[model samples]
Target: MRKNLFHNLALTLSLASSSFLASYPTRSNAEGIMSSSPITVVVAEFINESDANWWKEKYKSSFKNMLTNALSNTGNFTILEEDEEAIDRMTKKRSLGIIPGFGGSKKEDDSLQAKYIIKGYLSEYTENEISESTQVDFGAFGGGRMKQMFGKMGMNASPGGTQKSIKEVDLTFNVVVINPRTKVRAFTRTIQGSAKEEFLSEDVDMGFVKSQKKVENKFPIKRAVMQAMEESGKYLNCVLYLQDDCIDEMDAKEAARQAGNDAMDLF
Candidate 1:
């Protein structure tokens, strides 16, 4: 009788579990209810239309890869690399029977379908350097009492003190989000990043030989572009996920940027 009672209890629990699972057929766990699979997106190669003379075509792929990494960090989309030439080659191979298909199907039916496409264009990229030289004159007639004391000792000279160079880099990208089904550009915006670095060097002047070698300031182009791509990813995530808080914050930042620009325009 004890064994029978245990069997009956097991059967009852099984039936209850089955009923609960049937009622929620789409999910088997609580976590499944909170999140869904990431949406698939294709990121196209970035185009460089900027005024920078050093921009190369191969850098477009690098920019696309950076953007891909940025979007992947958001954990919202399954990013796919878009390559038209590779796709064309694959298609030709498949037609020539070099690539096999499942179930003898001639066409690729289980291919990846993207819900959205991201396009980027480098609209503006510039690097500017400003350098200033400082010197001290110790001429007796031209300078102060301190200069007169130094001049009396035969030290009448204009010695170069320091040279300061400030280099600034600005990068801007125009990003567009397109709906694959509707073929419409759903969102278009510009993302920008700027970086500046200051360098100081002493100008040494020996009596016989003068040597002033100016070291090139390594502009942080990758840093600026990566930051811009990160912002683009977050903005895309906000729009794609319909996150109100992120959207509000982005809007507020844009408004503040515009206000600051307007304020600068007064000068």
Candidate 2:
């Protein structure tokens, strides 16, 4: 009886050791390979020109705010705040450190040392014209003795009693992304749109109406900017080998175990 018991214990120990070794290799530590470092991104001040004039400080400030908001929405990288003092210091350092044939190294001017930097220019133009149209209509009157009445609706009236006017505007945006250190452009894309307005009132002059129309046209600009950023973010993530939360690790392990069991015909 004692010999039989000893043989059974040895067999159990051997089987357990073999199972552990087969399931997990000695170097299979998943934690060490996962990265938790956050990437930094910087936005340079945008320059805008309209017709022959550049926007003043106020408009430039507004544009910067818009750009910052768009970038933050991407949720892919940390955006660095612009520090004028730090930027000046870095620029001076770069100028002093430049070597011959090095092309005046200005990489240090990019304060963020970001994986990517985005810069762009925007230009907008708008125009409006006054025009007139003539139309014919038919109506009947039945409240007077052989009385005839004729009237015309104003230019604002449509066939459906709804007033609509057509206004148009042009928008153009150009965006470029570059690697700060190498100065190599990673991406460059431009998008433009011509938008037509459906509502304009004669009570408001063409200038006021067209101004409103231009505001409405900004919708397309916002959409284009978002699309460009999304594409850029995809490229950045690819370069970094970014891992997003697609599935839980535990769930994946359970799936693998089930698959292995099915393959081995061991339900």
Candidate 3:
């Protein structure tokens, strides 16, 4: 079952990502003219601290590719092929160059056009099984002895067969966009999403019987991660460029402009 579900995760990913993320604002000048320069961005594969090595190895490409592809799909950014060694060097060298008395500068950064590096990590990547439950009245099965014992103890005895169980799966991650030049974390967010499958057994009364015998999973971890990425990608541009606050202003202005144009059409 694990192998079968793992193979089907790709299909779920496409279905999950069908809806594109939020609107992205174009960089503009003082004249409000949009800048044509494509924002350059680089992506690094997310780190996995989850003890699931198989999971990390399975979905590493999805984690990295989704970020870059999400940006590119906006048609406002250029995804740059970056060298891992060069990026590591820049990070270490940048930290070293900042001195209290001196200044902060890096020669390599001067030539680099990419302004943002998308970083991410998996906080949790696991799935668990769930069981449906219903309460059964043991009084119908003639439990007068239990009632008498409870009555002596001044306690009302309810049906011991009354049981309830639930199960669910979750995928969560922390994503950040950073500016290498200033060593600033531009945008930081944590996204948690889940994909639940149909109930294995609709008979609530019997669902919990031997529940632990078989673990039922609705979807693979990759699907849940993909679902999370799709949602987080919505705020990518806003966080990277600090456009979250001003997006509302821009939309209102555009709406007013349209209203004025409609009024003039009456002339």
Q: Locate the minimum summed-lDDT window of 10 residues in model 1.
A: 103-112
- Regions of candidate 1 where Cα sits further than 4 Å from its true position: 1-35, 85-112, 126-128, 137-159, 208-214, 264-267
Q: Write the per-residue lDDT of candidate 3 for residues 165-233, one digit (tens) a residue.
A: 454567667888887667799777666667756543332233233222234553565567667777666
Candidate 3 lands at a TM-score of: 0.52
Error of 2 at 261 (Å): 58
Decide which is better by TM-score, 2 or 3.
3
1 against 2, candidate with superior TM-score: 1
Which sequence of candidate numbers ranks them by TM-score, best first?
A: 1, 3, 2
Look at candidate 2 and tell me the lDDT of residue 194. 49
Error of 2 at 239 (Å): 8.5
TM-score of each: 0.68, 0.44, 0.52
Candidate 1: tens digits of C-alpha lDDT, residues 19-104: 99788756345334323678777788888888888788898889899889988887878875548653343334444544234433
Q: Evaluate residue 258 in candidate 2 and report its C-alpha lDDT on the 0 to 100 scale.
A: 58
- Screening candidate 3 with a backbone cut-off below 3 angstroms (N, C-alpha, C), the clashing residue pairs are 130-167
Q: Residue 227 in model 3: shift from native, Å?
A: 1.9
Q: Residue 4 error for model 1, in Å?
A: 28
